[model samples]
Target: MLDYAKVIVTGSPISKSNFKLFNMHGRAILPYNSGKYHDRYAIYEQEIAFCARLQNPNIVLSQSLIAVLKVFYKSEKRHPDTNNITKSIFDGIEKSGLIVNDAQITRLIIEEFYDSKNPRFELELFGESRYNMKYEICTKKILDEPKEYGPPSNKKNSYLSKKSTFANTKEAAEDSKIHCSICNKVINAENSVTANNGKMRICKDCIKKLF
Candidate 1:
């Protein structure tokens, strides 16, 4: 009955208790709904078009870098503590203008794990290899999948624009008073703000001062 579901793993010996399960990277499937399954392939259709997302790309980038940093941190052993690793990764993310949260990072890691086999891929979050093609595919596949089960609708989801009616929100006015890290200048979210290291409290004009 699960049409879209693929045998992620095949040829594994199944007992009477378990059968027709797809296994990959040590994860097993219990036969979910076909549309609820990994039917993203049917939606995206094209590989290149599917791999693009603000959140997923940033996650892949962060994970890759974290891996490399872990190696060097380990080589030094006790010197670079976990805090140091986080700070270093945070700095790199800041420079690259990626604004993400710790929770988001956690989600990214978990996502990477569920769909992938390489523990190393998710573990090492700070390195060049994080940007590899394989990671890209994984992120794309995960992101493009339908958020809910059953056949996807042709209707588009309604979105509330961030810039829509800032007047309604109480904190909107005070947002302009925040200071920029690069230039130490005040900036507003609406006027010009660039987020790096998951903190958008800085202004783009001020960020330009970094150079």
Candidate 2:
């Protein structure tokens, strides 16, 4: 199973109030009289940049995502309900292109705490599989049978880094240039992603494989 990945957003979380709606005659409607939509839209624009190049290779669109949020307050003694902020959070993530839709998040766990020094919500999106993945465990489940886990190993996966020495196949690496480690094809250095922490370089197409 793949581990849960994290995305850190450094800002005061915008409340769901920004997405609030007014009630008409037995109907609910988004208020168009205010600039809330414009403000929220601007926020979404800035948030998408953070989601760039943040996909995991082993997991993509698992259909099962759990957003674990740690909300920190600046100076408030009593914090607002975490659920109340979920709408804005979901909208931000969807607009950020992290997930196809907010409904894709089948599971959500939100908790609030005080971090007066640094007030922001830390979000971690956990994935399971392509369609029906299971990435979480219920805390209420009985612990009488502790699940067995294997010991950690020091071995690393070098499938991508196996061609790190591609320069030997051609001219000297210094005289030549880097190539896509996965495809073994040459591409621009600026466009490539640092594979295996600089051990290898991959193009945009190959980097998508990581996710």
lDDT of each residue in 112-133, candidate 2, tens digit only = 7777788777777767453233
In angstroms, give how far residue 115 of model 1 lies from its true place.
Answer: 30
The lDDT values for all models are 0.33, 0.62
Residue 98 error, candidate 1, Å: 3.4
Best by TM-score: 2
Which lDDT value does model 1 have at 123? 25
Candidate 1 residue lDDT tens string, 42-84: 2221221122232234333323232222212212112222333
Q: Per-prediction TM-score, please?
A: 0.18, 0.46
* Candidate whose lDDT is highest: 2
Clash count for candidate 1 is: 15
